[model samples]
Target: MKPSLASNRRTDRYQSKTACITGIVAAIEDQASRPNAAERNRSAGPIV
Candidate 1:
């Protein structure tokens, strides 16, 4: 069988949207923990 012309582009868009949402949530959490962000970052490993 051959690959379909309709690829995963549509699903990719949805996945990007979800990523945006998570980014927003992380932003909010960062704000909420603004004071400890530096300390947390120091203790935490580098993000992938």
Candidate 2:
């Protein structure tokens, strides 16, 4: 069924905000661990 924009607006907005916050936190944590990472130059991040 096609979703109704009016009904989904609040839910979509909440999800978007939540996703942004989560992504930012994850990025910060990933960067924080960089100094100790054995291989910092890899695209996949520190190679354990």
Candidate 3:
């Protein structure tokens, strides 16, 4: 059976959002562990 277009779009949006959130969390964790905030921020880049 074929999937609906709306469902596909929703799934895509959810995946992208999840990825963005995950990246942000990782960046935060890195910042907490590392002393250099500047480097962590740079590594995080657009994710934060």
Candidate 4:
């Protein structure tokens, strides 16, 4: 079945919103982990 214009618009909007959210989440995750990774490496006391 062929989709209507309204349906196509809705699909486009959903995709755009999802992409925006995913980008925000990725940014937050990277920022949050940055400190933890540095601390772990410093405290590991030289990997054998």
TM-score of 3: 0.61
Question: Residue 14 CA error for candidate 4 (Å)?
Answer: 0.3
- TM-score for candidate 4, residues paired by index: 0.56
Candidate 2 TM-score, true structure as reference: 0.56
Error of 4 at 7 (Å): 6.7
Error of 3 at 47 (Å): 11
The numbered model that scores best in lDDT is 3
* Cα RMSD for predicted model 4: 9.4
**True-structure lDDT of candidate 2:** 0.71
Worst 10 residues of 3 by lDDT: 1-10
How much lDDT does each candidate structure score? 0.76, 0.71, 0.77, 0.75
State each candidate's clash count.
0, 0, 0, 0
Residue pairs whose backbone atoms clash in candidate 1: none
Each candidate's TM vs. the true structure? 0.53, 0.56, 0.61, 0.56
| Per-residue accuracy of model 4 over 1-48 as CA lDDT, tens digit each | 334566777787777888899998986787687968656766888867
Model 4 local distance difference test score: 0.75
Q: Over 4 Å off in model 1, which ranges?
A: 1-7, 35-48
Task: List the candidates ranked by lDDT, beginning with the highest.
Answer: 3, 1, 4, 2
Q: Name the 10 consecutive residues with the lowest summed lDDT in model 1.
A: 1-10
